[model samples]
Target: MQNTTWGAIMGQPFGVIGYSNLGFVFDRDRIHEYQTYWPKEETGLARDVYIGFKYQCVEYARRFLTLKFKAAFTDIPHAHNIWALDIIEDCTKEEGTFPFVNYPNGSKEPPQFGDLIIYPYSKEQRFGHVGVILNVNLEEKYVDIGEQNYEEAGWECPEYARRLIMKIENGQYFITNKRIGKPYDNWDINEEIFGWKRIDFSQKQ
Candidate 1:
């Protein structure tokens, strides 16, 4: 029999691995279901939900990396390591500018297993969004990360294929937006067991 604690999410494209409880093929191999907070529908409720999910997803992604890569993982050691949303926001911590702390840049050292991915909403470099590098390859420049409400949700846009398109010729990693088609039981649930942490961090205090 199959695992049935929760059901795979529906209405989206991709499968949920009941084992990990992560939503898949959104913009990466996996993204936190918390993203439901700021859905493409862009409803007021969605935005409100995003406020809490961002931070939780941040920690979740970090934990996921640590668990998946084990010895091959590098950590982001700052509470503010997440996206600034507003550039003027504080980034005073020494670690704020440190490696793997903030970036679209990959760590040149060991645990080079992944790179940092940033989605810039505004023209300025200090805001918008951030995500971790999931995978990369020279022949196929594709990146997979935990992301939400991708601007294109995997479509073609000016200068490049927005959303899920992986770089074919440049860049150090292979990043791609998740493509959605007919989904198979998309609902995914976690944290109901009581010991799970309810993460909340869309904006730092």
Candidate 2:
């Protein structure tokens, strides 16, 4: 199937609908080439348990954590079937599997690398979106993210994992898209963030 554009799927149903950039294979040789590949319906083992649709944001986040930190979060539901917000809830309920600490919107604690950032669902969207925190600079107040499903939109929208500027005021965190050589565009984290989950390996027992 041809890749669907952001505009084409804007008012339609959201969630993993086979539209991906990771193609079919989970190439360990080129695992770092996340941007070039589309997520497909491949499956594999993480903690001696089944995982979900490959190349999707949920799958990539889980595999990335398992491969990079030896942390396995197998309790999360199928990426293709579940809402993005439910992943956080599932992780929070799972005991002694993988540490999934949830920080609500406007959280004071800064997000760290490998954290799962959850976006809120809108009236038109049935499910929200997810991304992995690639970098965080509290001093500079910006974060770099790694995600799928958010492809480029011709000349308007940016591609996966753009750097976003963040701010903390009145005990709340806010974010803005940082475009090179252009004015910073404020992104409503207050409205967009349902919550963020961090993989705390320390909780594994």
Candidate 3:
């Protein structure tokens, strides 16, 4: 799969679907077609940073944080475990950590851009799933997210992988599993979104 700006959605398994808002989104349908072990040397990342398995949802979240904020959390056992994290290690500068905030699925706090959206564990996704929130459209009632290993199709938009419906009730936010259209995958009510985690940059010194 070539690393182009945009990928061709030719229904090819394990091919380059396209570039997300930050990192490349690869098709994770076929396990035999791609390498799951992505070493730091192979990924061109710092030796200390360990982003999860290659093309997994956690990998995209960590890689997005690393590329955009120059920070990342420690290795996690699963994608949903990220809800327990409170800070992210700074990859550059002072080598310190930045505190992050976790908002639950039905929180009054609305999700902002660049937040790490997490999905819960279920029969469909045993390891859970995570993605970067690209944009939040309260008016349109949808959120544009970028992720890998979620769907095996190409992105419908230039900057996002998929769009999930977001509804506000009594001033509380809820990101539903019901998708708008295109690149259909296995997202359903059972695969509920746990919430989103955002770095509090103001805590940075």
Candidate 4:
């Protein structure tokens, strides 16, 4: 297992780390930046669709969908609220929406690449958390995810922020925040993962 301990270099701007896969940058968010009001001038958008805060976890997730999958979702109150969504806006299609399926934690279905990993509200994460799965390696029993505002550490791998353990038991897939028996996730793993949400493009046609 790679050392979980991260070193922050001095003079880094707002704890900004480099980009995680797909040209989406992740940051440390050291100032605890929060803006209760969304100004049209400050809101980040792609193709005129809202993409949440500048460096929040939700921002990265939405940006991933926009740039990679040509998908969009309307404003959500919190990151955890994403799980309740039933459809995703098809940015490339006019007046179109695509079905989004949720696979709760310990479900029979395993998470796939491009799925959005959602976390429930916990004491540590008041608004909850969200991340995009970059890869799922069943053979290696690990899942690599990319996100922001979760950890200050630089990428453990070139394309991912961190890796989590995955195991299958009795045909059900389960995820643990730990990477190879050691705690690698920064949040409280006890809250457990709510599950993953995927845009079912197969339903579009």
Candidate 5:
């Protein structure tokens, strides 16, 4: 893909990332950026049901689903109460609200494109992490994800979304590389995978 201004702003190609069959086809024409916010305040804050609070992993995932598939979710807490695991549980309970189907790790069925990959927090961590699958290669046993906030690129980290690779082995999935970002790097595959949920477009009615 030709390097455009947006690609230069993102500091990477909006196209394929090398010979790896596992990669993403980013919409270079689209402006992909959002403000980062955390640590919910007691003061009243306006929340957009679709775009969500800027720069949050959950926000981006929700926005992606809404824009890409025209899906929406309700009854979700507007504040920090919405944890990564909460997303899986919420979708499971409110079946037809969002186009998500929960799948625990080690299931015979693996994650596919557009799946929301959630990582649970460890004892040292306070909050979990989340990402969206951009590509999945079952034969190669790997998945590419688009995520925000988990990295340590300063305050605008959320707008600086990037792709990372996750591996699957012995019917289990794990993130082997620690270079993607912090807090996320601290997550161990054995303990972090609370589960993943796929956005079933067919469910949209």
Candidate 6:
């Protein structure tokens, strides 16, 4: 948004950290881990899947955007414990079914306090998972999103044969994308834990 030092440091850019930058160097190892599999679900707990808030929000901020996975992982510092406590309660749900709600802007968008973290209730191969959309990108995609490791929030991969874009639809959140040059949608997993969304800290009272 503002792209200020704070934001820049928080989102993982390039040439943004160094030995002089203690903030960046603090969690350098995590960058190594994120690079190992980040932007790719292949990254799991023992493999980079830090499923909880640490991995979802805080650790996510640590990701620095760069062709190098480690560079992307160095995006933010001190994010782990920062966002674990907030909750987004204002997200607009549609028909409680499969529907994509539009988050306009300013006052019109959902007053989503933090990241709207959703856990997978089910699993279909590598597709079953979780994600965070802390705020609505009003100017650009207007698409609600958060720290997506893998690639630009990691929504473009077609795992499980053909799956991409994890979403919460009809009271159920699932992953969808495409396989073999085709659209593949909705692989509901109504039974998952650790998945969470973030509430806007600035908006909190």
TM-score on alpha carbons, each prediction: 0.32, 0.58, 0.75, 0.75, 0.54, 0.27
Better of 3 and 4 by lDDT: 3
lDDT of 6 by residue, 84-162 (tens): 3332222122111111122211222232323223332233423323233433332232233334322222222211111
Q: Candidate 3 lDDT, tens digit per residue, 104-123?
A: 99899999988889987878
Number of backbone collisions per candidate: 19, 8, 0, 0, 0, 45
**Local lDDT at 17 for model 5:** 21
Candidate 2: global Cα-lDDT? 0.49
Model 5 ranges off by over 4 Å: 1-48, 75-99, 153-191, 201-205
lDDT (10s digit) by residue, model 2, range 1-205: 2344422321111121223443355568755653322222222322242333544556656555554554545444433222233222122223335446777657887788767677656542235567667667878877766665544321122323456768778877765434333333334323455556776555454
Clashing pairs in 3: none
* TM-score, predicted candidate 6 vs. hidden true structure: 0.27
Give the Å shift of residue 75 in candidate 3.
0.9
- For candidate 4, give the lDDT: 0.71
Could you give candidate 5's per-residue lDDT for residues 1-205 as a string of tens digits? 3222211222211231211111224454533443323211321222333355444456656655554544434334431223332222122222444335667666667777666676665553346666666666666555656654444432213222433445666776654333344444444434455556765555443
lDDT of 6: 0.29
Model 2: number of clashes? 8
Residue pairs in clash, model 2:
20-38, 21-37, 21-38, 22-37, 22-38, 22-39, 23-38, 39-55
Report the candidate with higher lDDT, 3 versus 6: 3
- What shift in Å separates residue 23 of candidate 1 from its native position after superposition? 14
Query: Over the stretch 86-175, how does candidate 4's per-residue lDDT look in tens digits?
Result: 999877755688998999989999999889999988888899999888889988888987776676545565457767889889988887
Higher TM-score: candidate 1 or 5?
Answer: 5
TM-score of 1: 0.32
Q: What's the CA error at residue 56 for candidate 3, in Å?
A: 1.1
**lDDT of each structure?**
0.29, 0.49, 0.71, 0.71, 0.46, 0.29
